[model samples]
Structure formats: structure tokens, C-alpha cells
Target: MAFASYPSLRDKVVFVTGGASGIGATFVSEFHAQGSKVAFVDLSEDEGRALSGKLAGSWFRRCDVTDAFALQSAIRDAAEALGPITVLINNVANDTRHDAASVTPEQWRKALAVNLDPAMVASVAVYPMMKQAGGGSIVNVSSINAIWGPGHMPAYVAAKGAINSLSKGLGREWGPDRIRVNALSPGWVITPRQLELWLTPEAEAEWSKLVALKDRLMPEDIARMAMFLAADDSRMITGQNFIVDAGRL
Candidate 1:
């Protein structure tokens, strides 16, 4: 089946975080397919490099998002190689299940570091470039779990909830400069990480029972929404949280 195409995306430079695998990798491939020059960073060096090698004009760097300096450096390096970034996808996150009762201060800080800080850091790093380019789009990858607030993931839920707010805050702050910011909230996408550590048959069955749509969600499903958000088609859209979860919300 054929999908929509964005003629405006051709030749645009896109930067994605946590983009070596899962939905992030799909972001890399899909944007490249749209004729955008894609550059991505992730901790998974092997997958990142392999994906970069597969795509003719793609760039990849292995950087831990938790390290603000490293994350900023990678973004700068990508900008240096590709042109000024016109699109930013803040897709880095770790949603490991943990007991709320047992979460230490350090663990809580770490959770925010992984899920929240990099978005701000990357956004700040790209602000001047986007401003110089006259405008840009920023997609903050959020999760429906932020709304669902399920048990065993207190830290993740908190951090993701913060991301939603951050998207709005940045949107308001950057709108004057024509920088659009919005959150993309996905529901229960069965990426490799989810399938490996969670998503047991029972969990899958339970999720199936909840959503209105019959088909399971895929990385491409989420990435397509991101494509629209990143493209000029969404130029006037900002500060909104788009939920792409098969009507699960």
C-alpha cells in the first residue's frame, strides 16, 4: 500500500535521538525515504552505524543522552556535517518498570535524565540554527503511559508526563522564532525493547482488548505520525500532543 509523501521534506536536515533502533530507527529510515538528510544519535553504536551505512546520506553518532554535554556535542557535530537542522525528534527514553516504593533519589534523577533532560538540551542546541533558518519543527516523543499512569513505572510515568509539559513550554517559548514544538504520544508500540523485556502474551492480549483498533501498533505507525509532525505540512501546528495509539486513548 502507498502512503502520503511530503514534498517539502526533501533536502531538509533532521536530527533524531535514540534513533539507532526501534521507533527511532524507523524515524531515521522513513525520513531518509522522504529525501531528508537524516542524522541520528544513540548508545547502540553497531545498529546506528549499520543504519547509517545503509542510507546514502544518513549520519549516526553513539552518544548517551543522559550526558548533556555529549548529547549537545553530537547534535552540533550532526549540524556541522548535515546543514542546519530544520527538524528535531527527541525520541530518547527508558521505560524500565520499577517499584515506586523503592525508587531512590538517584534513580529518580536518572529517570528524568533519560526521559526529559535531553529534549531540553537538544532543543536549546538547535534553537539558534532553527531560528537562523527562519523556522523548524520539534517532535518530543511522549507515551500514553503518561496518561494511563500504570503501576510499576512511577519514575517513567513522571518523566514522560514532564515531557508533555516541556513540549508545550518550548512551543510557547519558540513560537516567536517560528520554531514549532509538539509532543507525539504513542501507545503500546511493540518495539524490540518492549517485546524483549515486557509484552508477554497475556500483556499483549490485554492490550488488544483495550484499544478500539484491531491491528497491533508498529514502529512505522508511530514514525509516520512523526513524519507529518516534522514536515512542513505541520508548520502551523504547535504545542499540541498528538496521540497515535490506535484509539487506545
Candidate 2:
């Protein structure tokens, strides 16, 4: 399917976290297709480099988003290499599964570090640039699990829950500056990681039975919503949680 293009996105600087693969990588490619100057960082150096090479003029860096300093530095470097980032996609996340009963204090901290902290850190890093640009969009990649509360992954659910509130709080605080903050929640997007780690036929069948849309949710499907949120079309929209979950609630 041919997605609509946004003229405002052309020549804009887009910064994405964890853009080496999965939904984040799709964001990098899709924004680049819209002629946005894309700069992405991921821990996967080889994949990041390959993606950057595939898209001429795109920038890639190896960054572990858990490290607040490293994440901030990467954003700064991306801005310097490209330009002031007007679109920041906080797409870095690790929804690692674990039993809630077995979770330790360190494990809880680690989960928040990976899933919750980076969104705030990255958004803070780009605040000045967006302010100077007069306006910008910040799309925090959250999950429907934030609301669903599937008990198997308690930490992930908690972190994502925070993301929703974080987006709203940030939106309220920064809306006066014209920096819009919103959360993009995806439900069971079949990415490489999900395919490798989970997507068995039996599991897929069970998931299909639950969602309103029977088809598989691809990365581009989620990326397109993000593009709209980042573009001028969503100028009046802010502080909301958009679930691209195919009627999963």
C-alpha cells in the first residue's frame, strides 16, 4: 500500500532511538522515504551501519539507551551531523519477559532504565533544539500492554504505563513551547525480534482471535502513525495515547 507523503517532513531532521531493527528501523526508512534527514542510534552496530549505508545521507551511531549520558550524547551528535532534530521518536525498548514473583530490585531498576528512562532523557536532550525550531513533535513508542496489564511481563507493563503518563506530563509542560508529546502504542507488531522470540503458529492464532484485525500488524503499519504524529498534520494533537492495535483496546 502506498502511504501518503508529508511535504513538511521533507528536509526535516528526524532522530530515532533503537533504529537498527524492528519498528524503529521502519521509522528510519519511512522517514527517509519522506525525504527527512534521518539520524538513528542503536546498540547493534553492524545493523545500524548497514541501514545507514542503505539510506544515503542518513546517520547512524551505536548507542545503549540505558546510559543516559550516552543517549544524550548520541542525540547531540546526531543533531550536529544532521541538523537540529525536529522529530524525535523514542523507539528504544526491551520488553523482556519474566515472572513477576521472581523480579528483584535490581531487575526492576534495569527494566525502567531500558524502557522508561530513555524517553525522558532523549526528550530532554532535544527540548532546546525543538524550542529553537519554533515547534517539533515527540512520539514516545509505548505499548498497549500499558493498559492490558498482561501479568507475565510486569516490569514491561509498568514501564510502558509510565510512558503514557510521561507523554501527557511532558506534553502539558512543553506544549507552550510548541513541542508536542504523544505516545504511539502498538499491539503485537510482528517484527524480526518477535518472529524469532515468540511468533509461533499457535501463538499467532491465539493473538489473531483476540484482535479485531485478523491480519498481521507489520512495522510499517505502526511507523505510518508515527509519521503523521511527527508531521504538521497533527499540529493540533498532543498529550494523547494513540493505539494502533487493531481494536485490541
Candidate 3:
């Protein structure tokens, strides 16, 4: 499907985390297609390098988002490569399911660190850059799992819920600076990992019965929402959770 182009996105510098593959990769590609200068970081060196190589005017850095120092350093390097970041996409996450009863303290901390901390860290790191740019947009990729309160993976759900709250708080704090903060919560996105681990024929059949729309949610669908949030087209939108879940509530 054809997507709309945003004139304001042209020449903007965008930094994306977890952009080596899946939904994050779509974010990088879509933003680049809109004429934005893109810089992305991921733990997968080979995938990151290959993606960057394929996209002109894009840079890739290897960094683990859970490590604050590494994440901050990568943001700095991205800024040096592509001008100050005017758009930030916090898209990295791991949604590995686990029994709540068996979750240890370390596991819980790791879950939050991976799914939530980096968004805050990256936002803080780029705050000055965005302010200096006169204004910017931050799109935090969240999930519908938070709202649904799924039985398993308590930590993952908790992190996403916190992200929703964080987005609202940050939005209020940064509104005066003209920096918009918003959350994009997706539902049942059929990424490579999901296809491999969860999207069995039977599972797909069940998911189809859950949403209002018949079509499955794709990475591109989420990317399009990110593009809208990042562009001037959504200049007044902030502190809100935009759920692209095909009416799954």
C-alpha cells in the first residue's frame, strides 16, 4: 500500500534504536524514504551494518540499549554523523514470555531495563539536541499487551504500562519546549520473530477473530504511524497512546 509523504520530514535527522530488523527496520526505511537522515543502533552488528549499507544517508552503530553508557554514546555518535536528532524512535524491546511465579528479581530488572529504560535514557540524551533544533518529536513504541493485561510475561506488561505513563509525564514536561512525546502501541504485529515463534496457523486464525480489521498488522503499519507522529502533520499531538491494533481492545 502507498503511504503519504510528509514535506516537513525532509532533511530531518532521525535516530532509531533496535533498527536492525523487524519493526525497527521498517521505521528506519520509512523515515529514510521520507528524505530524513537516519541513524540507528542495534545489538546485531551484521544486520545493522547491512541495513545501513543498503540505505544511503543512513548510519548504523552497534550498542546495547540496556547499557546506559553505550546507549548515550551511540546517540552522541549518531548526532555527529547526521546533525542533531530532530526525531527519536525508541523501538527496541524483547517480549519473551515467562511465568510470573518463576520470575526472579534480576529477570524483572532486566525486563524493565530492556523494554523501558532505554526510551527514557535516549530521550534525555537527545533532549538538548531536540531543544536546540527548535522542536522535535519522540515516538516510543509500546504494545497492546500492556492494556490487555496478558496472563504471562508480567514484567513485559509492566514495562509497557510504565512507558505509557512515562510518555504522558514527558509530554507534559517537554510541551513548553515544543518537543512532542507520544506512544505507539501495536497489536499482534507479524514480524519475523513473531512468525517464527507465535504466528502458527491456528494462532493466526484466533487473532483474525479478535480484531475489527480482517488484515493482519504489519511492521509497515506501525512505521506509518511513527512517521505521522514524527512529522509536522501531528504538530499538536502529544501525551497520547496511538493504538494501531485494528480495534482490538
Per-residue lDDT over 44-123 for candidate 1, one digit per residue giving the tens place of the 0 to 100 score? 99999999999998999999999999989998999999999999999999888899999899999999899989999999
For 118-185, candidate 2 gives per-residue lDDT tens digits of 99999999999999999899999999999989977998899999999999999999999999999999
Please give each candidate's TM-score. Answer: 0.98, 0.98, 0.98
lDDT for each candidate structure: 0.93, 0.95, 0.94
- lDDT per residue as tens, model 3, 1-249: 666999999999999999999999999999999999999999999999999999997999899999999999999988997799989999999999999999999999999999999999999999999999899999999999989999888999999999999999999999999999999999999899998898899998888889899798999999999999999999999999999998883
Clashing pairs in 1: none
TM-score of 2: 0.98
Residue 147 CA displacement from its true place in model 2, Å: 0.6
Stretches of candidate 3 exceeding 4 Å from the true structure: none
Runs off by more than 4 Å, candidate 2: none
By lDDT rank, best first, the candidates go 2, 3, 1
